[model samples]
Target: MRLIISGGGTGGHIYPAVTIAREVARLSGNCEILFVGTKHGLESDIVPKEGFAFATIEVRGLERRLSWQNIRTLCNTAGSVWNSIKIIKRFKPDVVIGTGGYVCGPVLLAASLLKVPTMIQEQNVIPGITNKILARFVDKIAVGYKEAEQYFTRYKPDQLIFTGNPIRPEVMSAGRDEGQRALGLDPNKLTLLVVGGSRGARSINNAMFEVYKHFSGSPHIQILHVTGQNEYNSIVSNIKQAGIDISSGGNIIIEPYLYNMPLALAAADLGIFRAGAVGLAELTARGIPSILIPYPYAAENHQEFNARALERHGAATVIADKELTGSKLIATIESLVENPAILSTMAEKSRESGRPQAAEVIARLALCLIKLQSNNKR
Candidate 1:
């Protein structure tokens, strides 16, 4: 199987594409996978490291407001489409899969125009602008949330599938004891994992300071906080200035970033983080109940919708970014931690909401589509 998987801009989009590509390669022993993304996207850095052939096209997302810059964007998009056409002609992929990002626009459209099979995976309840536009053109639409189907009402039922977000396999396979040992935490204590995506969240970090203070003396609970690299120094300084010694705070472990996230997620009894679709999927897959704070500035405010979906399923709780405060956050954390029965129930519900095999499902679908196309040609 020859495949072109295009998606980028953020981990939310890039990781899913990478996971799907990996699965496709595993299923089809001789699969050739090429990743197309913009030069500036996170994929440019990540894809090559993952050992996939990577290509870049010059493309920029259109600004929402009317501006002169949009004229330049229009010109670039046209050029990108032409570039995509050339790439598609040369690669001759059996299928092109797009996980949501602006980069997907030109590449998938070019594939559709060239009469190649194409599919897109949307990672949020509310679709992004690129995926929404591509929905009419693509052969199949895979969504992370079931509620997302309502947005693509124009597409026939068979065109859409609720496969959930593709999560890293390590997250599913890591055991709680393994995770606890890796992170150097006691297996018997209630462990709380706090993370705010790859780049830390200022609001979440600030709220966590108070939560940290509240649990400073507790011996029954342990906290693992991943303050994004950029925010690490400032957060540490602020803690010191507040007269709190984080290093000596017996049960707390703080780091700028977590390299072993599978371990962190596996070890966590509860999680506090932003509700990007991928993160939510991992939490549910691990059966870890979370307190989600959706990033307010995300495209289409989709993070909030993602959080609400989990909340609706009784798997997690939502605290709007605007209303998140140290007091409120600490209170919510206390409520969940203090009640073991409720926490266990929420964990079970979270596990129920997970789709651990989403990557394999999408990979099989793409390969099946390729097989069908080959038969049609005969």
Candidate 2:
């Protein structure tokens, strides 16, 4: 089968698109895939590296309120739709799938206009504006959270499915011992993994000072903090000024990012993370109990919605961005690590809630869509 997948902008959208594409390819054994995304989005850089044929459309997001910029963007979107039409015609895909991003808007619209089978995957409890609008046109809507169904008001009930979020195969396959050895972590100590996102979280970075200060040189646990690339320098300088020892062989490992995050997640006993849907999916896939600090300014405050859902599942605890502080963080960490029972219970719940096979399920659903379309054509 020939498939076209579009999703871009941030890692949250891009990663899911990539994972879904990989899953689909794995299942079909003989499939050709094309990825459509904006040149400016991270997909341009990441898609090629992932060994997928990548294409781009020039489109920008609209402002919340009416403005000259929004008008310009809308005009550009029309041209993008035409551009997408050309790409879709040349690719002649059996199915088109969108994972959710502004870049998916034109590609999915063009596919729908062409009457090709189309589906979208919504990854948050609060549906993104792009996905919400595309729901009316797409053939199916695969949601990460069941709570998101109520928000997509325009879609037919039969069109929606809850398949959970797709996680990379590596995330499920990585081993704890291999991860520890690869990252130079000690197997005997409890490993705490802290990450904000690809771009990093300033609040989490700032709040971690106390965590480092408190846990420095502790024999029981080791901290691996991924300070977003932009914030790494300042955070490291601050650590030096604070006289905290993060030396070559110290118990703490501070870095800008981890390309091998599946390994990191495998080695992690606990996690502190921003409440991006993809990040939360990985944490749960690994069954690592976590404290989620939702990004305050996310569209529709969806990060908080995502975090609260996990909290309800007893898989994670929510610490609002505004309420997060070094002292507060230290206390939460202490509370969990000190009480083995609570952490273990959270881990079990987290493991229970994980849909490790979500990618495969969604891939099969897409294949079914393709088959149905072929039947209707016959």
Candidate 3:
């Protein structure tokens, strides 16, 4: 089998594409897979590291408003379509899959035009502009949240599939004890994990400083904060200036990044982070309740929609980014932690909402499509 998968820009898109690629390889060792993404996207770094064949196309997202940049983007998009056609013709993939990003626009569209089977995965309740446009052309559409269905009304019901967002396999296999030992965190204490995506959010880090200060000397609860590389030095300096010795604060662990995120997620009793679709998927899969602060700048305010989906399921609590503060965050954290019953119920609800086998399901669908196409050819 041969497959072409494309998604990029943010980790949310990149990780899902990688997960699906991994599943495809696992299910069919003989399969040949290629990933197409923009040269500047995170995929350029992540895909090759994961050992997938990688290709690049020159593409740029359309600016939201009229500008000289928009003019250049238009020209680049046309060139991207031609480039995508060339890639598809040479690779002759049986199926092309797009996990959602600006890079998906040209690649998937070119596949559709070439009469090859194409699939797209939408990772948010509110569909991204790229996926929304491609929905009309693709053969199948997979969505992380059920609410995403209404946005793609142009497609037939059968064309839309609710295969929850794909999660890394390691995240499901890692155990709490294993995670605790990996992070050097206390096994007996309640663990709180704070993350603001991979790049880090300034507002979240700032609010977290207050939460850290309040929990500084607590022996019953431990905090693992991933400050993101960009904010780590400044956050550490501020902690020192405030007279708090983070290094000696036995209950707190601060790091610029958590390279072992599977361990961190496994160890966490509670999560405080942005409501990116991918992050939400992991939290639900782990049955860890979270306080979601949606990135207010996300296109179409989709993060809020993703957060509300979990909140509605009783798996998470939503705090608008604008409303987040140290006191408010700390209060919410205390409320959930202090109440074992509420925490347990939230955890159960999260598990109920999780789809750990989403990658497997999507992989099967892609394989099915490839099989059908090959059979038709024969």
Candidate 4:
């Protein structure tokens, strides 16, 4: 079996496509999978390292503001469609699947034009430009949230499926006891896990630093903050200047990033982070209660929508980006940490939103598309 999986710009899009590819290969032996991503995207570095063969086309997202760069980007994007057509012609796969990013726009357009069976997986509550355009021609659409369905009402209902977002297997395999041991965290003290998205959120880092002084002397609760690699140095330098010792703090452990986040999430009593689709999915799957601060600048303010999906379910609390201050954040954290009953209740509600089998469902749909396409040829 052969398939082309396209979609990638950030880790949010790249990781899910990689997870789906791995699952597809595991279930169907001898499957040939190829990834299509942009030359400027992280996929160039990420895909090859995973040992998957992939091709890169030059593509750029549209500029929100009026500028000459917008014109250049528009021309480049048009060129990308032609480039994608060449890739489609050479690979000639049985099916094409896109995970929803700007890169998907050109490739899925090429797939649709060629009359190949195509599928798209949307990870956010609000549809992105790529998914919105490809919805017309794709044979199937898998979504993480049921709320996303209305966005594609123009399409036939049969085209959309809510399969949830596929998470890394390592995330599912982690256990609470193992999590605590790996991080040398105490089993008794209330532990809060703070992570920005993969690249890190500067707003979240700033808020944490502002309130960290209050926790300096507290022995009742501990903090594990992942500053994200890009912002790590500045965050660390600022903390050191504030006279807050990080190395042996009795109640705090701050680092740039956690390579084993699944373990950290498993061990956490509370989580504070941005509400990207994967971050929310992992939190829900592990039943980790969180204070979600959606990225203020996301296209269509979709992060807020993603957070509300959990907040309405009683799984999380939402703090608007503009309203997140040290005092407000600390107040929210103390309220949850001081009350184990409330935390437990929230954890249960978080689990209620988790869809652990989302990857399996998407894989099944991919195979179904392949089979349907093959039988049509017969």
For each candidate in turn, the TM-score is: 0.98, 0.96, 0.97, 0.95
Off by over 4 Å in 1: none
lDDT of 4: 0.88
Query: lDDT by residue for model 3 over 1-378, one digit each (tens)?
Result: 788999999888999999998898799887899999988988999999988899999998987789999899988899999999999999999889999999999999999999999999999999999999999999899999988898988779889999999999999999989999989999889999999977788999999878877888788889998989999999989988888776666999989998899999999999998999999999999999989999999999999999998999999999998998899998999899999999999999999889899999999888888788779889
The models' CA-based lDDT, in order, is: 0.93, 0.92, 0.92, 0.88
State the lDDT at 123 in candidate 3.
Answer: 92
Name the candidate that leads on TM-score: 1
lDDT of 4 by residue, 176-273 (tens): 89999999888988888989876788988998876678886577778898888899899888888888775665778877778888899889888998
Candidate achieving higher lDDT, 2 or 4: 2
Q: Can you write out model 2's per-residue Cα lDDT over 122-182, one digit (the tens) per residue?
A: 9999998899899989999999988898887676878999999999989989999999999
lDDT of 2: 0.92
- Going through the candidates in the order shown, the clash numbers are 0, 0, 0, 0
Predictions ranked by lDDT, top down?
Answer: 1, 2, 3, 4
The TM-score that candidate 1 achieves is 0.98
Better of 1 and 3 by lDDT: 1
Taking all chains together, the TM-score of candidate 4 against the true structure is 0.95
Candidate 3: count the clashes: 0
